[model samples]
Structures are given as C-alpha cells and as structure tokens.
Target chain A: MAQQVIIKVDNLVKKFGNFTANDNLTFEVFKGEIFGFLGANGAGKTTALRILCGLSSPTSGQVEVAGFDVYKQTNKIKMNIGYMSQKFSLYEDLTVRENIRFFAGIYGLSRKIIRERTDELLNKLNIEELGDKLISSLPLGWKQKLSFSIAIFHRPQIVFLDEPTGGVDPITRRQFWDMIYDASNDGITVFVTTHYMDEAEYCNRVSIMVDGRIEALDTPETLKKTYNAKNMNEVFLMLARK
Target chain B: MDNPAISIENIIKSYDKVVALDDISFEVDKGELFGLIGPDGAGKTSLFRILTTLLIQDSGNAIVEGFNVVKDYKKLRTIIGYMPGRFSLYPDLTVEENLRFFATIFNTTIEDNYDLIKTIYRQIEPFKKRLAGNLSGGMKQKLALSCALIHKPEVLFLDEPTTGVDAVSRKEFWEMLKELQKKDITILVSTPYMDEASMCDRVALIQNGRILEVETPEEIVKLYPHSLWAVISSDMYKLESDLQSFEKSVSVYRFGDSIHLSVKDDDIYGSDIKEYLESKNQNKIKVEKIDANIEDCFMALMNNNDL
Candidate 1:
C-alpha cells in the first residue's frame, strides 16, 4: 500500500527581511507517520513550523498541509490540524473540565460529542477524578497529559507538537511518547519538533534543519548508519557543528 | 576523612499546604560533581535556594563550607557560586560588563580570577561587546557561568543549567562542566534529563519532595531489580497496547524506537514474548534481552513508590 503524502513542501522559502529563516526547504510527511523536525537554536525550525501550521505566510514556493494550500486555503488547513506548543497554554484558574470544554467549544465540536469524548479522554488518562480540580494544582506531568488530550479532542487529521515533553521526567516523557504513538496508530499524522535528540529516534522519519536548510532527512536507522554515529545526539552534533 | 563540601539534614520546606521538600537529606563530598535528578516541581529549586541562603528552610539544617545556611548566611554567601534556572543576568549590560559587575560585587577583579574561568570565559570572550540579551542560548550560559565563577567560590550550585538549550549546546555545556570539575571545585547541579545523570559522580533521584535513591549512575542502573527486554514490532504502538494486557509483563514502556519490558528474573523469556505477539499476527516481532540504564532504575523507583 502506498502511504499518502499528508504534508508537502517544495522549495518553501520564508524570510524575515534580509535573513532567510527557512531557505528553500523541501520535505514530505506521509500519512500516520511521526515526522520529527529537528534543529538547534536559531535554526529556523519554529519559523518553518509556524508556516506549516497556517500561522505565518511563507515568502515563496509551494506548501500544502492536509491537502490544503498554505497560501490560499489556510482556514481549511487550520480546521483539519491540531497544534500544541512548548508552553503549557491551559488556563491555570480553570478546572480541568472547564479547560476541556473551552477548547473543544472553540474547535467547533458538538456539545454531546464533546461530553462523550471528554469523559473518554479522562478515563483513558486515568485522571477522571481530577476533572473538577483546578489546573494550577495538577503536577507538571498531569498538566502535560491533559493538554495533549485536549489538543486532539477534535480528532484532527494532523497534530503539531513543539517540545511537548520539555522538563518532564524520563518516565513521564516515555508515557507522552506512548500517547504520540497511540495518535499515530489512529491514522493521524504527527509533526513534532524537539530539542532532545533521543526523541528523534522515536520518529519514523526525521528532517534535521541546520542554518535555515534541511541538512539531513531520513529514517533514524539510515541516518545513524550514513553518519556512522552511535545515536541521534552524535548525529545532531555532527551536522549542527558544521 | 574531611567534612563533605555541603551537608543537609532533614531539611523541610513548604508553601501554603504544599510540601516542596519533605525530610530531604544529602551530602556532597569535596571536589565532587553531584546531580539532583528529577522532574519539575521536585523541590530542586527550593533546595538550591536554601543551600545558597536565598530562602530559609521551614525545618532542619543545611551547611555549606562549614557555615550554617541560616545563622552563618552572611559568611556562607562569599564561598558559593550559584546560577539560577532562569537567566537572571543583567540583560542590558554587555557580556564583559556583566562579568566585570559580578566580579566587583564579590570584591574582586576579573583579572585576579582569570585563570579559574579561562576555559569557559574564552568561549564567550568574543561576544564581550554584545548585550547579554542578544547572545545565543549557549553563549548566555557561558557568560552566566563566567560571572558565577568570577569570585572563585569553593562550591557551585547550578539549577537546571541546560533546561532550554539545544542538544548540541547541552553536550558542549556538559563538557565545560567536566573541565570545571577538573579544577577540584565542588559542584551540585540539578537537571531533569536522565542522560545527564550518568555524567555526575553521584545523583539523587527526587520526586514529590522526597529522594528515591542516591547512588552513582552505574550503581543506580544496577538497582533495576528485574531483567529488561527490548521489544519491537512492525506496529509498535499496537504491540505496546497488546503487551500491556499480558499477565506476565511486569512493566512495559517506550524506549526510543522500541518498548522496554521488565519481567521477573529468570521467568519471562524472549521466545515467549515473540510467540505471543506472533500469535496475535504482529509482524516483524523482535524481542531481546537488554541492559538497563539510570532511566530504567528511576522508572522502577517511581512505580514502586506510587504503589
């Protein structure tokens, strides 16, 4: 079976005045695949991600997300994708249930479906009892998990997570990856950016951006073999140092 | 035989009804690189503040360089270098100005302690004219460490130094820490990354305001009580869910591209898991015995503590 290309970019160029943030980048993310967008600080990864998420317009070239053109059909593209940022954007004063309802409502989910899914999500994450608890009282891991469940509550075709597990413990990080894998298994493509190189291994394919360009793009196995590196950390250093 | 570089006994801290540190106790030997390993809100910052005399503990005692954290704080302040988690340097000041300002505050000249920070300072020296805010993440870290060491303190306390830095920069920063360790400076560093735990001479795994275990990285990994197996399949996500249903599977969690399964010693075999997943029509099934790391030990401890 041929996997469909869910995200397509060809010579995508994004510039901020004299500087090129994403310089003629080209890549394809297949359906249901965990595609890792990796880069160091000031490497233009966030710019490229924002452009893909329909939050920013590119300077030139072709870009498509979820079968919608980024330039003209941004609204349609936004309707079919979910985005979770590095910062925990949940309301601190609101209860967990209230936060879920607020986000779900904004996403245009039906009230009945929202109620059903909210219950299901709470049960799945083993936090059903904490639904009435204020978000500020939750631990960092619980808040992260809750935020992730809320992001995908509408069941978007693609999800964008930027450093979703930063400052989390290893065990919690593993669990978060499990959540990502579960989403991938459900036929939803995952587009994630992270600073942890070890996480690059979890992706089916990864594209490393260096100095506003895609320096390497391949499966973790092939990249490690091609670079003759023991792990993704070494692979990242090899390219980033250049 | 000499007193440890830093010592804490039954230190407790709380904010309102939330207990941040409960009966925490630890010691750092002279010239040792120690790590406080845990997730966020694990009381690392609270503990660092107490040791540096920036915050008072609710109960118990902490001593740095033979001075009580509470009573002798005035004297203790001069003997320790502290870099907080947040970038607290003067953003408006140039890199050199910040370094010089910090040196003057400690009543010393950058030239007098130039040898102590020569290695780290050289990295950021080129950016001396740049404002601290305009420098890159890695460069800012270098500048901050330079300022912290300007006074040549007897010990260093770094709270999550590499929290938001890039992986390449993180590796470089750890290397610089190794260089600093060579100077025989007692260092206590806290980070959430388990991989960094192995770099320290010893680490204390803390969670929910309590220390789970304190030992060398190698020894902590050796504490993983059960044998571990790496399991992979064509559909790893489904495989993980299916494996969790198996009664014999003690604990299963994702590790990189594969799932690590912990089983009773000499009880569960690789062949048994392969047959089970194969019977369920999971393709490309591979299960093999593997060695555990500090992360595995931490998970085991967390699980046990939760139960």
Candidate 2:
C-alpha cells in the first residue's frame, strides 16, 4: 500500500549542545516520488540532510531511511541511498570516467555495469570526448553535471542531492535536472535539498524549513494558493518573515 | 584624468598552459555600469583582476582611466576601487577599523570620503563596533562595499558581488551599485546569475574563457533564433525524450517543471507537437509559443556556438 512509506521521520531533534539545530522535525518521503527538503543556509537544512544520510545522528527522536533505523542501521541506509553534497564532492584529480568508476566501486557496483553506465552517462551529457579529461579541466557547469550523474550511477533506491545546481549556468542546470528526472522515473526516490526556489517548484512535494522546523510542506501550487502568493519567492518571504 | 573610463583590445590572459581568457575585446563607456555575465571560471574574475592591476594579462592591452593595467598598474591601483567576490575583511578587525584601514591604504581618511560612502555606510553604522566576521552575510556585503568606496576611486571593479546572499540582499546590493554609478563613476561588475544581467546597461556572456555575446539584455533576448514552448505532462522525463522524436524538436532543455523546446520551423506549431506527445503516453500536455528571456538566448547562443 502506497509503497509502504519508504522513509518515515518522526520528531527528529538534533542539537549541538545548547544550540538547537533541528527542533521537533517530522516528515515522510514516500517511494517513487520526488521529495524536496529546502531551507535557507543556517536554517538546519544541512543538519537534517547529514542526519538522513547517516553522516550524523540526531540528538533525539525516531528516524528511518530506506527502512533502516538511522541509529542502528546507518550502513544499510548508506547502501540504499546516494548523496551529492553542495560542495564539489568528487575528487579533482580524477578523470570524469574515473570519478564515476570510483563512486561505483564504493557502492559495490560491478565492473561491467560501471563501464556501461559511465559510457551511457558520458554520451547522455554529450561530453564523451572529455571522458578522459581531468575533472579540474572541465568547467564548473560540466563538473557539476558530471558529479550529479556519478552520484546516482549505482542506481540506489533513493538519492540525496543537496543544492545540486548551485553555481552552474541555466543551461547546464537545466540538463542536470533532466537526468534527475530520468532517474526518478526509473523508481528511484529523490530526496533533495536546494536554495534555488525555481528548482523547488519541480518537486512532487516540498517542505520549507525556517528556524529548524518545517514552515511549509505541500506541492508548489498548494503552497502558492494557501499563502496567496504568485511565486515561490513570495511564499518563502511570507513564511520567513512570519 | 580624461579617458573614456575603460578600453580593451584583444585582451588574452592565461594561467600557465590553461587559457583563462581568449582574445577578449570590450570597452565600458564613460560613467556606464557594465556587467560581465558568466559562470565560475569564465574569466570574469580574471578580466576584473587585470583591469584593477591585480593580475597581469598575457597579451594585448587595457586602459582604465588613462592608466594601463601593465604599464601603469600603480596609477591604475590608485584610481580604481575593487570589491572581490568573496568577503575578504579581517575577522578580528571591527567594521570601523576595517574601513579606516582601507582608507589608510589609499592615503585618505574616512572623514575625507565619508560623503561618498555615506548612504551605504549608514546601514552598517550600527554594527561598526562589531567584529567584521561576526556580522551577517548581508551586513558583511554592505561593509565590504562601503570599504571599497572609501577612497572614491574613479572606476569600480566588483567581481561576483552578490553570490551566496539572499534574493533580498542581491536586490539591495544592485540598488547600491546603481546609486554609485550615478555619481559619475564607471562601474564594472561580474555575476553568474542570468537574471542579474538585465540590471546592467550592457552585459557580455562569456564561456570557456571566450566571449559568446555582448549586448544589452533586451537586445539579446530579442535576437533569440527560434520559437520556444514550455511543455509539461504527467510523465515529465518521457516528455523530454519523446519531444526529441517530434519533427519540431530543435533542442530540449529542462526548465523547472517544464521542458522548453526550440523548434526548427515557425509554421510547425505547438498543436502539431501536442499530437506527437499524445502518441508517446504523455497526457494533459500543455504547450504554447512564449517569449524567450535572457537565459534562453544564452543557451541558444551556446547551442549555435557548439554547432
């Protein structure tokens, strides 16, 4: 029924000593759907993303990722998901194809699939000529798209992309999301965080965070309608100022 | 003292074997607010650094306020104000102290040029006693900008000045730049945001260390080659792949929830493209011929260049 709720997070509270980063947070991301988790910088988006990725543990409250309890089954969750962070997460010294191979190996992908996928990804990006080129040699736009493709190459059940399009051109960012859509269509759940308001409008459902808690959670249209706003920027402004 | 603000001819800059700028030639009219619109590593920073005498170009020449970047760097340094992309204020120094330090570097006092930066300085006046690093991002932007304007340089160089700040801060920062331009100062700012390109009097879209197109934002958008459509459906991914199968598909680029398609012919309408989508299992498809903005033109130009 409804894919049995692939991710269920309940009142997840994460604090750094006296400072509360994620306060009384609760959310659920169903399987086979794009769930966007968005927030301003220092609003606890990264804190929550780190917790969900099993990179860090919540200070309190129940949490689960891909049916694995974050407290006890972090490695299992890691295997079921892929993460592309805001920072350039790939090795600069590695070639485009080599980065793909390295990330694939970390996820226990076979050599044959890695080879096939690397070629396919390179071809899809229309940059197969640059496959052997150093990652540093490519433009930031190309590097971001390549890093995005490599992150989800292992075909995990869920992929977490944090600000995947920051600092890229509109064309490159456009193409990057196309590949994201291709993956989600193949039944991979996308749990992404972004500061780009335009990108948030693409999600099936999005939760806007403010002051360590969800201020809004709904489809773009629903949030827009509820707040009597014309664009996502206004809706965010209304919520942030409130 | 009497030059057309800035002028460049066949400017080429490289870092060792890597070419950062390739035969770039552009000029900023006297008191004009010119913009360099491109992504990271697009050489906007390199060009700014060269114009400000911070980095020397490999070849060609540039003149800023009658001073050359290579031959008259010391003279150029005294006449140009530069605010770098990153916030480069001293963490330990207070806002007032930082301002004073920059004033001292230019052989001037804050009191001498306080009138020039009065409007911007007022915003950070309350936090003047606070450590530069302790201020918020928006506040730090104001402080950095105020310090740059402390000496009242004849030409201003701002490199990616609004990145990482909120939309509100970006808007506010641009407003401040416009006010600065009105004081008979030549302003040159570089940014990655396509939307910000319109705020300038003219912009140059650069890529791969090459200048793609240089024109006003409205003129660039007006010259877009093809008719555009924003198509959306239930199965968005398939819509992208299937749109390629249609005869009208020239190029498909994902834009938020919709796929913006550029077609070959004007007579081949969206209705015809809709029928093709129906055959591909995408329902409730909406399509229309819409206006192409600056970003669309940037991509179209990029596509044309690639071909």
Candidate 3:
C-alpha cells in the first residue's frame, strides 16, 4: 500500500537578513508516522518548525501542511495542527477542567462536545478527582502528561511537540512515550524534536539537521549501521562533529 | 586525612508546608567529580542553593572546604564557583565584559585568573565581542562556565548544566568538566540525564529532596535485584501491555524500541514468556537477558522508595 503524505516540503529556505536559518530543506512526513526531528542547538529546527506550524512564513520554497499551502492557507494549516512545548502549554492559574474548556473553545469546539470530551479526557487520564484542582498544584510529571493530552484534545491532524519530556523521571518519560504511541495509533501524525536520543529510537523515522541543512534521515537502526555507530547518540556526535 | 570538600549534615529546608529537602546528608571527597542526579522539582536546586550559601536551610548545617555555610558564608563565597541552572550572566554585556565583571566582583583581574579559565575562555575568546544574549545555547553555556571559573575556587557547583543541551554538545561539555577535574578542583555537578552519571566518580540519586542512594554507578547498577530481560516484538505497544499482564512480571517499562521486563523469578526462561506473548497474537518476538544500566536502576530504586 502507498503511504499518504501529510507534510510535503521542497527546497524550503528560511532566511533572516543575511543569514539563512533553514537551507533548502526538503522532506515528506507520511500520515500517522512518528517523525523525530533531531539537531544540535542553533541547527534551524526551530525555524523549520515555526514555518511548518504556520506561525512564520518561509523565505522561499514549496511547503504544504495538511494539504494547505504555506503562504496562501496559513489559517487553515493552523486550524489543522496542534503545538505544545516544554516552555509553555497549560495555564497554571486555571483548574484542569477550565484549561481544557478554554483550549477547546479556542479550537471552536461546540460547548456540548467540549463538556463530553472534558469528562472523557479527565477519566482517561485518571485525573477525574483532580479536575477541579489548579494546574500549579500538580507535579511536573502529571503536568507534562496532561499538557500532551490537552494538545491533542481537539483531535488535530498533526501534533508538534518540542522537548515534551525534558526533565521528567525515567519512568514517567517512558510512560509519556507510551502516550505518543497511542496518539500515532489513532492516526495523529507526530512531528517532535527532542534532545534525548533514546526517544529518537521510538520514532518511525528521524531526520538530523546540521547548520541549517538536513544532514541525515532514516530509521534508527539504519542510521546506526550507516554511521558505524552503536546508538543514536554516537551517530549524532559523528555527524554533528563534522 | 584530608577534609571532605563539601559536607551536609541533616540539612532540612521547606517552603510553607512543603519540604524541599528533608534531612539531606552527604559528603564529597576532595578533588572528586560528584554528580547529583534527579528530575526537575526533585529538590536538586534547593540543595544547590543551600550548599552555595544562596539560601539558608530551616534546620541543620552545611560546610564547604572546612568553612561552615552560615557562619563563614563570606569567606566561603570567595572560594567557590557556582553555575546556576538558569543563565545568570548579564545578557546585555559582551562575553568579555561579563567575564571581566565577574572577575572584578571577586577582587581579581582577568589576567591574574587567566591561567584558571584559559581552556574554557579560549573557545569563546573569538566571540568576545558578541553579546551574551546573542550567543547560541552551547556557546552561552561555555561563556557561563568561563565566568564561573574566573576566580580559582576550591569547589565548583554546577546545577543541571546539560539539561537542555543536545547530545553532541553535552558530550563536549562533559569533556570540559573532565579537564577541569584534572586541575585538582572538587566538582559537584547535577543533571537529569541518567547516562551522564557513569562519568562521575560517585553519584547521589535524589528525589523529593531525599537522597535515594549514593554510590558509584557500577555499584548502583549492581544494586538492582531482579532478572531483567529485553523483549521486542512486531508490536511494541501491545508487547508492553501483554508483558504487564504476565503473572511473573514484576515491572515492565518501555525502553526505546524494546520493553525491559523485570521478573519476580530469576529462573524464568525466555521461551516461557515468549510462549505466553505468542498466544496473545504478538509476532517476531525476541527476548534476551540484559544487564541493568543507570536508568534501570533509577526506576527500580524509585519504585522501591514509593512502596
């Protein structure tokens, strides 16, 4: 069976004044695939992510997200995608249920559907009792897991996660990855960037960016074999050091 | 015998009703690279603040380089270098300006301490004219470390130095730390990365402001008391659920593409569990015994603590 492509970019270039942030990037993300975007700091991953999320326009390229043109249909693209980062996600001052309702409303979900989904989500996360509690009272691990759940609550076509599991416990980190697996199983295309190499192994495909260009893209096993490396970390060091 | 580099005796701290550090006690030998490993909100920052003389504990005391943290705080401040978790350098100042500012604060000159920070300073010297805020994440870290080392201190404290850094840069940062250790500086660094624990001479696994265990990484891994098996099948998610339901399974965790299954019985064989998973419609099942690493040990220790 032929795979369905959800994100298609050709010669995508993002430049700021004299410096190029993203240099002639081209990649395709298939529907329901977990795509890992790996790179060192200042490697243009953020620039490319901003362009794909419809938050910023590309300097030049043919870019389409969820079948909408980057330049012509940015609003449509934004409506079809969800974004969550470690730096920002939920409102700390609001209760769990309130945060859900607020985000659902922003997505233009109907009140009837929002009420039903809120209950379902709270129960599914086993936080039914904590629904009335403020987000600040929750632990870091719980907050992270809840943030991820809320990011996908509106059921967008693709979810972009930025360092979703940065400093969580080892056990909680794995549990969070389990949630990613569940999302992918439900046909939500996951485009994620993380510093942890072990998380890279969980992705169906990974692309490593270096100095504003895509250095390598393949499955973890193949990348390791190609670089004669023992793991993703070693492969990253080898390519990034060059 | 030489005195320990840093010592904490029953240090207790709290905020209102919440306790940040509960009876935390530990000692670090002189000229050793020690690691404090834990996740965020695990009281790693609170402990660092107390040891660095930034915050006073509610009870108990700490000593660094034979000077009491409370009584000798002024003297202690002059002899210790601390790189906080957040970037505390002046963002508006150029790299060289920030370095010189810190040097002046310590009553020293950049030339007088030139030998101490030479290795780290040389890397950022080319970009000395760049604003501290404009540097990349990796370069910013190098500049921060350089500022921290501007004055030759007996003990160095680094709080989550490699938290948000990429793998490649993280490796390079550790290499720099190793070089600094060779100069007979007692270094105490904290990180949430379990893999970096092995690089330290000894590590303290802390959670909820309480130390879980303190020992060499090798000894800590040896403390894991279970038969661990790495299991992989065509369907990883299903394999994890099936393993969780297995009668002999003690714990099941997803590690990358495979699931690390800990069994209650050491005598359990691979085929025995493979047969059970196969009956549940799992295909391409491969199971092999493997040794526990630092993360595996961390999980095991955390679970035990909760019980």
Candidate 4:
C-alpha cells in the first residue's frame, strides 16, 4: 500500500522583482491523492501551483510534476496534467458534445475512444439529452460539471483544479467533489487550490500557504488538532492573523 | 404588523419567462441580522434589490423601516445602505475618494459618520491613496463596506459581499457585521455559503424564486426529519455507491471527507451502517451519529421543492 510521490518540490522559490511570491516551498504529492493548496488572497499558493503546472517558472530550487522537470520538461509536464480554473474556461459558443470532442482532440485522444468516452460521460452525468445544447444555455452547476468532465476527458495523470467549486451552491459543490472522487478513484491525482474552508476539509492532505511560505501541511484532522481550531476557517484565520 | 424593521408581503417578481421572486414573504425585526441564503439565480439578489428600492416587484408590498419600498423610496434611500453583490465603487477613485463621494451624496460628511464605519475604514486606511481597482479583494470589500456605511443608514443590505473573498477576509467581514449589528442597525445579508447561515440571528432559505424555510439556524437544523450519520471508509466513492445500495437509505451525500447518510428508519444505528460497509470489504470504516447543519437542511429542502 505504499504510495508513490507524483509531485516533488524542494525549496522552490518564485520572485517578482523585489517581491517574493513563493519562498522556499517544499512538498510532496502522492499519486491519486487530493492535495489541497490553501491560502488567502495575497498568499503565494497560486504562484506555487503555476510552477508545478508549468505555466510559470520558478526562480530557484527544484520542482517536478509527474516526474517531469518543471524547468526543462515543461512540455512533458503539460501533457501529463489537466487544468481548470474558477473562471469557466469552456467555449460558450460550442455545444456540450462538440466541446468534449474539441478538447479530446487537442489531447490527441483517438477518435474512436473520444466518441465512446463522450457518450459515456454524457450518460454518466445524466445530461445525454443536452449533448447538442450550447454551453451558454446550461446552468451554473451544469457548466461546472461539464467543464470538469472535459478536463479529465483525456485521463491525465494529474488534474489541477483552481477553486473548482467557487460560487456553486452547497449541493452543487458536493456533486462536484463526487466528480473529483470519481477521477481520483481512476488513479488521477487531484491538485486543488481553493479558498473555501469546507472544501479544504475534503482533501486527503492540505498545505496552507501564508506570506509566501507553507504555514501548515497535514491531514485536515491533524491540522485542526495542531492549530487547536474547530474547522479549517478557524485554522486559516489563526494563521492569517499572525 | 408589529412595525417590523423590514417586511415583505407576498412579493412576486419576474423577467420575461423567469420568475425571479415567487410569492416570497419575510420579516426582519429591528436590530436583527437576517440572512437571505440561497444560490445564484435563486432570487436572493432580486429580493435584495426590491428591498433596497432599486428594483420594482410585479406584486406584493415590501417595507423597510416602516417606509414602503415603492412609495417611500426617495426617503427610504436616505435611511438604508446597500452594498451590491458587484463592487459598485468607482474603480478610478481612491479609497478615501469613494467614501467621501458616497458620504457627500447623502448630504453628510465622513466625520459625521466616522464612528459608524471606523472599523472597516481603518482596515483600508493605508490603501486610501490606491485606486479601488488596484486594491486587493479583501481591501476592495472593506472599501465597499466603508462607503456603504458612510451615510449611517438605519438598515444595511449586503448582497453576496463575501463572494470571491478569501477565508481570512470572509471571517473578518462577518466579524465586522457583528460589530455593526450592535449599533442597532437592522441588517439583511445574502450569501451562498451555507456555513455562514449559523452566524445570522435568522435566515430565509430561498431557491428558484421561492422561500423554502425561515427559522433560526438551530431551529432549522432541528427540522431535519431523519437521523443523520457521518460515514467514511478508505475508498470514499465506492463507499457512497455501497451506501446507496442500502434500501433503507433515504439520502446519501458527501460532506467533506465523510458521507452523510440520512436513513429512512430512525432506529437504524450507526453501527448498522458500519457493519454493512464492512460487509462490502471496506477497511478503515468510520461511522458516527451527527447533527445536520444548515447546508444539509438546505439541500433536503431544495430536493423536496424540486419533487
């Protein structure tokens, strides 16, 4: 039952001129684990995630995503991961099935498998009848689900979800997590960044970044106990206030 | 009838084919902090707009501070502060400029209302020179709140003020609201975060233009009609599917890392569910009886309303 470390960061640092966004950050993300990266508005979580995601380069130190070097193997790293942001990234003009096919094609998924997976995904979400419907016509919850399904369509080794459940209601948020669990169960690592305390509690392990450093990292239970807080919100407040 | 700080009598509003507020009615007593809790497109913002005299309802009466929203809107405008869901401050204006502008518009000086918005204003004081657009999310919200309070309104209406805000600022914002509540101002706030429901004195759960329930957080939780249990195992998604296989299960949904199950039979104990998960060959199984919170109650209500 030994877990493999898919993401490895060692003393990673990112600076913007005189400002240090991420300072000496180090962490290990195991395979298929839902690792939460939590922080306040100005915290360096986004910087660290971007480095891991190959979108932004680190100033110094070592970072590897899916065993690919962040600096030298950015293309390889990009291929092994999927990314979704809070801002709905789907094409509003494209139909649901068309969007799926487009993303699948970009990932170089075979046409036969893309057709099969597209049908299966629509069926699983119980939105088969709406496959031809434009993305803009869908509700917020449905759009979120569709975006998530599309993100994992190619079955990347790891998926990066940046505040995936933001603005959705509690029920929709829960259903979104179910989709996350489904992806994780299929051996896809989930690297999520969120401001929602309740969503942080869902992760197997979470790292809290404050003022360009990893303030705390552990299971939700352990972090609660260590900080002597009732919930993640209290834990975040306690750290942020300091 | 008892001169409630704010009262709505069977309000209904619509746009084209969409019913934004469907026969909704509620009351907020003086000095009370009432929350209008619901998701996006659930009529919360529409209700707030009507209450603040910014939008006209198709039917029903809404009164704020004993002044009818539609008839006494001119006077009501002077006595109520409204912080819309979107940040409405001028992006080009500095923090102080926005506050001063809002105060002068109400025919008052910032010094006259200095004590009212002191706490929120101080948070953004250092950034007074910065443009509202350039300020951070938390700072932007603080500035918005300060501007809203500069007029010293009798009642405050905030529509999703904390949305898109980080956890630290959200906690800070709620703390500020608690301080404002002590000033004897009747406050009506709306948010999509259900965890915040418990912070309000009372909340009206709205969805799809209808009021699902209105009660104190504890009272609403007590209304959860079934025994709930928190169930978890090494394999979570599989555990959810396994729990769904139990015919006695009324509802099973994920809450954080654990699955919250509301069984049909109240007599079904936590141990019974644990035993079943064990039979499914799930290891590290943990099941404990737990109380339902506002989010759970809201989901149940939403489902029932859908049916």
Once fitted onto the true fold, the runs of candidate 2 whose alpha carbons sit more than 4 angstroms away are A1-3, A16-19, A71-76, A96-132, A153-155, B1-3, B115-126, B267-282, B305-307
Error of 2 at B162 (Å): 2.6
Q: Candidate 1 chain A: worst 10 consecutive residues by lDDT?
A: A80-89
lDDT of 1 at B170: 85
Give stretches of model 3 more than 4 Å off.
B305-307
Native interface contact recovery, all models: 0.75, 0.37, 0.85, 0.77
**Pairs of residues clashing in candidate 1:** none
TM-score of chain B of each: 0.97, 0.94, 0.97, 0.97
Instruction: Report the number of the highest-TM-score candidate.
Output: 3
The residue-by-residue lDDT of candidate 4 on B128-234, one tens digit each, is 89989899778888888888899889999999998877877787789999999999898999998888898899999988899999999989998898888998798
Q: List ranges where model 4 is wrong by over 4 Å.
A: A105-113, A228-234, B232-237, B274-287, B305-307
Per-model lDDT = 0.90, 0.84, 0.92, 0.89
Write model 4 residue lDDT over A1-242, tens digit each, in one string.
Answer: 88899999999989999999999998999999999998888888778878888988999999999999999999999889999987856999999989998999988899999999999998899988999999877888898889988898888999999988877877888889888988988999999988778788889999988899999999999999999988888888888776
Arrange candidates by DockQ, descending. 3, 1, 4, 2
Q: Model 1: how far is B215 from its true place, Å?
A: 1.0
Clashes of 2: 0
Model 3 CAPRI quality:
high
lDDT per residue for candidate 1 within A5-90, as digits (tens), equals 99999999999889999999999999999999999988999899899999999999999999999999999988899888758569
Number of the candidate with higher DockQ, 3 or 4: 3
DockQ of every model listed?
A: 0.70, 0.44, 0.83, 0.65
Best by DockQ: 3
lDDT of 2 by residue, B1-307 (tens): 4457889889998887889999999888889898898777788888988888888888999998888889899878888899998889898999999999999999999999999999999988988999998987778888888888899998889988877655555667898989998998889998878888889999888877888888888888878787789898987767878987787678887766678898877887778888888888789899988888777887877776331
